[model samples]
Target: MPAPLLSLTWTDHVTGRQGFLVVDRLVRGVCSGGLRMRPGCTLDEVTGLARGMTMKEALHYDPSARYVPLGGAKGGIDCDPRSPEAYGVLVRYLRAMRPYVEHYWTTGEDLGLNQDLVDKAAREAGLVSTIQAVHPLLEDETEARARLADAFAVRVDGLGLDELVGGCGVAEAVLAALDRAGHAHAGARVAVQGLGTMGGATARFLARAGLTVVAVADVRGTIANPAGLDVEALLAARDAHGGVDRAALRPGDRELPGEAWLSTEAEILVPAAVSYAIDEVNQQRITARWIAEAANMPVLPEAENLLAARGVTVLPDVVVNSGTNAWWWWTLFGDIGADPDEAFAHIRRSMRALVERTLGRAAADGTTPRAAAHALVADRLPEIADRFGWYATPRKDAP
Candidate 1:
């Protein structure tokens, strides 16, 4: 049996305190993951994420026929970050598991913790802090690492991390789908649901890409403007928690049911808000030929099947959002620069490649984009699992 590419280790130092490290694929390139904090999160989940990261990096680095092994890894802390004491405790927990912080086990931000939290935790754990207030050159490196970490953290702290990835990944996938359909981003009408980090980022990116963002929705309500909503203006009006000031929206903006954005007449619909936002009930009302899953599990599997049957191509989350997190992992322990633009560029390339590959697979299989993309990962899973003996015999299902 092949040894596992992914391994899980846990340490118990402080009483009632525990931490886990999951090592995914061991790419000759670089392997990276995040430290997540959540209530009731199990070790199994962390390991699964590590494995996913491995596949993500593999698919991203080489989406073609060749399966180049790219290392992937992740870690998680079971705790809440809302309290100051919990924050300190979280740091101590990370410190206890510092031995795993390496090129193979490099960690970044995940659910429940932000970049600030990771930086502080790393500091407490005695891992060389990314911050360098002393050396000028070191400071540049520190700034770059911090921004990359911050991007991953904010995705979790502000909007649910999974949701953000799903939203943005789907947005990119939608753009690819539109291109396949011969539709253009320039002057295309768009509506976004769920205006958190993922939704907000998608809306901003689409607008920047020259799409006419006509509407956006959050948990609070929906805001629409047929003349194209002002992305920057709306962003400026957002509260500390990213809530938009409905009163500050443009004159034509009017409040409607939170789910109303799904039915808008826009040519592109981005459900960046929440899971099941485009379920069976409202699936038929979706007027946009292009629908992106900005939130994880946004469409029920059955619903997704239905959408594919009806000709709407859905982009899967695992493939699309993998870039930002993947880039964060690579740059954190490597020679990444401090400038945010440079960091963003590194991630965009990975994202663009995955999108192109997924689209190509869809064209070849005559299936939904998600299936084609997932198949790429699924097809490789066996060789990987065989190499690790994960599926030896009756599927041990070992933890």
Candidate 2:
């Protein structure tokens, strides 16, 4: 892997918390990713995520599309999101990274953080918008911003449209895998970890698609029911941090240890919670035929190898979770409007094609999905750079 163009570690003065920013590459003088706040976040983890963002961007590139892919970048702060000091630390970190956010990096929510909180913190830190760095590329900045805001306001069921797009792509990927294996969606069992923006939405989509969401894991623990838990009730009962209230579970629903989601009796498992959630040891307990990475680096490479050897398929996060990032750009760049149906149609078409190509590439090359995705990215990035120029030298007049 190539080195990141820039990497910085920041120490919060007020709370003494540490934060990290990694710019894996630059395209047209700007990069894009998300900001996550969680305890034990490290530079290494952010580096991997930033690189994954690069792949996600590359895999979605269409020369004729209005939303051209940007470079990769990520920001992370090491502090518990539940702590009172967390918001203050977030504001301080954004303030410290303001220059980059203004000129080079465009970020949004990831993991412990949400877009609402990020936007608020960005404003308090004197940022125009979390993604204002790309304003220069917009044909009409005001109209584009308004379009994106309207899109964000759109909700399907009870969740914001933005939150559902990623999960939409993920569910589509799962469906694609099932199709390839000739598996029936009607009764396929699924277990998902993390009921936040991604996981909760994923469970809803999968359940609605006729797949039984037999188990879902929140910060509290795993909620399991063989006949399938009530996804809507769990979603309604979620706290801001993705924890489920015990009272919301159905009569037959049982709570298990936090890690029980891994061992749940399910054909598909989604680890959407944290980095390295499935390591070598824990991976041994997973009986799921397919693992979709809804979180960045949820499966370590070694564990993935072990699973692959055991006849499991691991769908890489770059393709599965890229829809959220792509949706933002699609709306901002006028590729799609504020319509939920249009947005979902665009996501499904693009994500389905992407997943099909990735799986096909893996089959032809005899490589893992992650490796195939990486190869696709490796091929596309240079073409993107050649056509648009990498903008290796930072522009002095950048705002």
Model 1 stretches astray by more than 4 angstroms: 1-31, 35-51, 62-89, 92-104, 129-172, 273-285, 329-350, 378-399
| Least well predicted 10-residue stretch by lDDT in candidate 2 | 390-399
Each prediction's TM-score against the native?
0.69, 0.98
Q: Candidate 2 lDDT, tens digit per residue, 1-399?
A: 889999999999887899999999988888999999999999999998999999999999999999989999999999999999999999999999999999889999998999999999999999999998888877888999999999999988878998899889899999988998899999999999999889988888899999999988887788999999899999999988888989887789998999999999999999988889999999999999999998888999999999999999999999998999999999999999999999989998998899999999999999999999999998999999998787643344445
Candidate 2 clashes between residue pairs 3 or more apart in a chain or in different chains: none
Q: Give one digit per residue, the lDDT tens place, for model 1 in 1-399.
A: 123455565544553645677665554323567677755556766776676666666575433313234456667666554544567667676666655463235565555555665787687778774222111222245556565455444433244332344334445666666776788788899888766556677787678778899888875888998888988788767763357988787778778888788788888777754445677767888777777765444677777888778777666656755655554444544434434455455555556677788888888998787678768877775665555334122212225
Candidate 1, lDDT over the whole model? 0.62
Compared with the true structure, all predictions reach lDDT values of 0.62, 0.92
Cα distance off (Å), candidate 1, residue 195: 3.3
